[model samples]
Target: MAAPSAGDRGPRVTGAARGGTGRPALARCVAVDPTTFAAAYWGRAPLLSRAAQLGAPDGFTDLFSPADADELLSRRGLRTPFLRVAKEGRVLPETRYAGGGGAGAEITDQVLDERVLGLYADGATLVLQGLHRVWPALIDFARALGATLGQPLQVNAYLTPAGNQGFATHYDTHDVFVLQVDGGKHWRIHEPVLPDPLERQGWGGRAEEVSAVAQGPPALDVLLAPGDALYLPRGWLHSAQAQSESSLHLTVGIRALTRYALVEALLELAADDRRLRATLPFGLDVADADRIGPELTDTVAALRAWLAAATPAAVAARLRERAWAASRPAPIRPLAQAALIAALDRDTRLVVRAGLPWQLVPDGERVALRVFDRTVTFPGACAPALRALLTGAVSRVGDLPGLEDDRDRIVLARRLLREAVAVPADDLSGS
Candidate 1:
């Protein structure tokens, strides 16, 4: 399967809380137990969870309804990269249905429902990109899932009319959870031609092999209805077409880690080594193998030395930090926080920021508190206060048990708030 063009996919992640914490959305969204799925099928094969409903109460249906499509298309004036129209396995150009000039000379693409609807009537699939950024419900759900899975997450939606297909048989670079939100879609899933492909190894060049394999009997073929979900691991070939009724499904892609990513983190850590940072022999060129050979050999030896010194645990820790940096932080209200910080007091309630992952390390006389893309070191005497503050339980700044000085405790609390490691207990939005 060829990957969608950059515009079709749009900029990814250009886009959460406690009490609803610890519970991963995936647990509720899958029919089989999460443990069972992880142990048996995760990164191994396709999983079809029948009658799975994400975002409970209202289910996934409320996230984007037919009414929403009508409202967004006719009134939102969406531009390219936000919406894409594909027909018969090909994506239609934005200009085909979008325009540049209007009565006011507006430059953005105005999504005319009539034009979009007309294309849909003729079998085009409408794709909504970056829904996690645009929809609040999806944002919360994505965050919950990310925290649960310990990976970055993104969301997209595909709406295909009856008896139509969006794209030809293909595989995704990232694992996807396909949630059928409305109507039904017939799916044909084949075993991976190349199992566990990396991000750079896309689906484009392997079309012939994919086609050849797909011609044989599929490993799994079924019709997915509303509230149903299909989990396809990366590199698993699959395709789906709308049934007699139109279909709308959400694809929640997990940007999973690979060995290559771990190596990247290792390389970054190695850069600090003088040997790794040294320049190659000068005047090295395609024709100068004699000189190039020794230089290349030396570089390889140095890299090997770096690798030999590396421990798996240390490398894993670095990769974990990199992943945390890439993920979006728990939601925060800047204005509210600023106002609250200005009125800092002993009576203010604080709790560890919902869904925020943190680490505290002992640093001799100081304690290193690492969180929210930054690290702060405080006197070891404040360890009790810091530990209590990060216990995920709510507490008033004034009532913290171990800390006695109101001034010092208040200062530490304010610093924690500023770093986004904790939030006021009253702010439900932050939670």
Candidate 2:
């Protein structure tokens, strides 16, 4: 679909039922059709929208107050990893950099000690465990975008201040939908100049480094305000910078399984076959080597032909699996007994991890507790007692139904409390 032009207004969107109030609360000013865009430029750059994007709720900040953000940053061992501008194509270790604060400062110097800027642990980075609690609005946005793209979606968020460039200009491995949540930022999108642009499988190196040699002048340059969004297909070289203030944005990265990935996965599935597992050129003799060449080529050709024929079906199945799999929640690891007790005493507010399915239903004696994503369902007879736990109320196991002498329920509930899936009742109010 063509991007909404500066003078043209895009489609209007109303808030979904879950958005509450039943009124048209959140709306988008521009909405480009993804199918048309994908057909024309699946791996190219395209600006999606620049209007009404800011109408999405900002309630995510309320979930994590400045104090909660600080506690999370400190407790999770989160660090800012610096990307060497020269090696922008390479992934850096997570611990290599430190937070630089709101005002710009040298990596070696620690001037402002505030938690406002630099590399902070985004909820995704630290707890991959409780994203739903950290950014509920982004989760909803992902579902909306997924419906638009006709595929599953994953959303990640990051915050940076003026002069803090997260990474150097480069291409993403996957297509991306960038939403400017708060403040404004600048983007530089360069046209694809390399032959077979966006086809980096045979580039013999990372796309970022390979494209650097063929870098062209940016085709589009724009400053995105709070409600603006941009879509850049895979292999499009781009860079972003916050405009003299702090910025927060969510990047919805779409994972596309290409032919290369399918073949790789097939190879993995074929690992038990001696022919598939054997290294090529199996003999040292010159005659044997010459004879093996044709056979080896034939084997590769067969594999390629098979993959080429099966790719569409395979990719569709994989996408469906990924969509369902993405909804499952990460298992919460148990904390030390002492720490768990302390956390409970402090009346911490627990939050469900993002994407996990849950429903409230009436059971026989009380209410049945069924956690859909996890496939764990228990009788409603435990409702009266489990309801409090589900509601993050501070109640002991003894207060639960059918658990007077059972210790397993107590242990399980304690584990949940430690994971912040359940917390004391008082802490629930603010969050």
Candidate 3:
């Protein structure tokens, strides 16, 4: 299935965290059980699972194939950042692989197939970023895997001609799973120069250290064949070179939650303390450590008091805001949803959007439906029907709970359909 154009989807972000199912996606990558992987190698170590050792006989081909890459590069009218080319260790400028699309397109950076072809022949590596945002299968797989791991995730694919390497020995600030989709790639992995690096600490800061680490004996040295997978935590030094044939692999990067994030949440909660916001003494020598010592001591005491009084619930709310805002729910076809609203009737079938995180909250006399970025409120009488439709399975408009009249049910269903909270069940067949 193809992706919806950004114009067709509007302001809604199509990438959501929930995979809408069980742990099958995680199974496809980690050879060990989920519990075992979490305890042993999740962030502290690396795990490698060969093609024969992983789940699903089809491996990763179903998620993304070579043909799929071609379709995106040539037919998807892709823009930069979403797709890029690298030779040696440098990313080629957009002009190298993209140019103006002919009349009516207006876009100047639409990918040019001939340009990509020339670069591939010259040993440039194709890096396709954000496959989860544009590719249907990857969208589902990433969402599922993120749900299982309780982390924000993204997917990128690398395609290199034989004997070429796209990037130098380095480490990412986030964890990664390398899923081999086609051919072979010889890999050399070494221990981390800096363990558990935060987002702000990039490999560039310690390029010298990383280069040094790569010179040491590898902790693991192996060729990843089709269907094989490798898991690496952040700060691990590594590099790969394509074998005889071309190499294609998907990198599923995980933004694992950290203690620092929790500290951020707690500090945000500290904003409520008036002492923390108070000014220092007037005419105080701010730059002098001797003069500032007493002030810092008092400030520490005040902060300690605030921390002692803080509640887990308060910090949790801030974390929820940060995490929820970073992700998006499934996209709705606006035009199709509009059509469904116009034709909504008792017999019309409807289902809540898959993996949508929403709830009905009491808002005075009205009840508010909290989903995505906005709160949609309805009169208190609609609560029963909202609960039935949102919390229940795929159902008929007439089947909504507590709304005695079929007209009331249809009206509620139509309003919800307009809100993009639910879609016509038949729309699920496509992406």
Which lDDT values do the candidates have, in the order given? 0.77, 0.47, 0.82
Q: After superposition, how far is residue 294 of candidate 3 from its true place, in Å?
A: 1.6
Using alpha carbons, what is the TM-score of model 1?
0.83
TM-scores for all candidates?
0.83, 0.51, 0.90
Candidate 1 local accuracy as lDDT? Answer: 0.77
Error of 1 at 320 (Å): 3.5
Candidate 1 lDDT by residue in tens digits, 1-431: 12111111101121112113334477545666667878998899888877733434444665567667667677776666878999988999997777764687568576666778789999999998877776666777777777767678788889999999989998889999998888999999999999999888888889999989989999999998887888999999999999999999999999998888988978887886799788765766847887678878888998998888877766756775777776665687888888888898999988776666666777767778766477688888877787776774438898665666899888888888887777888876445
Write down the lDDT that model 2 would get: 0.47
Specify the highest-lDDT model's number. Answer: 3
Candidate 2 TM-score versus the reference: 0.51
Which candidate tops TM-score?
3
Better of 1 and 2 by lDDT: 1
Writing each residue's lDDT as its tens digit, candidate 3 over 270-366 gives 8778888999999999999999999999989989998887776566556666765655556678888888788888998887776466656667788
Question: Per model, how many backbone clashes are there?
Answer: 1, 7, 0
Off by over 4 Å in 2: 1-30, 33-44, 53-134, 147-152, 193-215, 268-289, 297-431
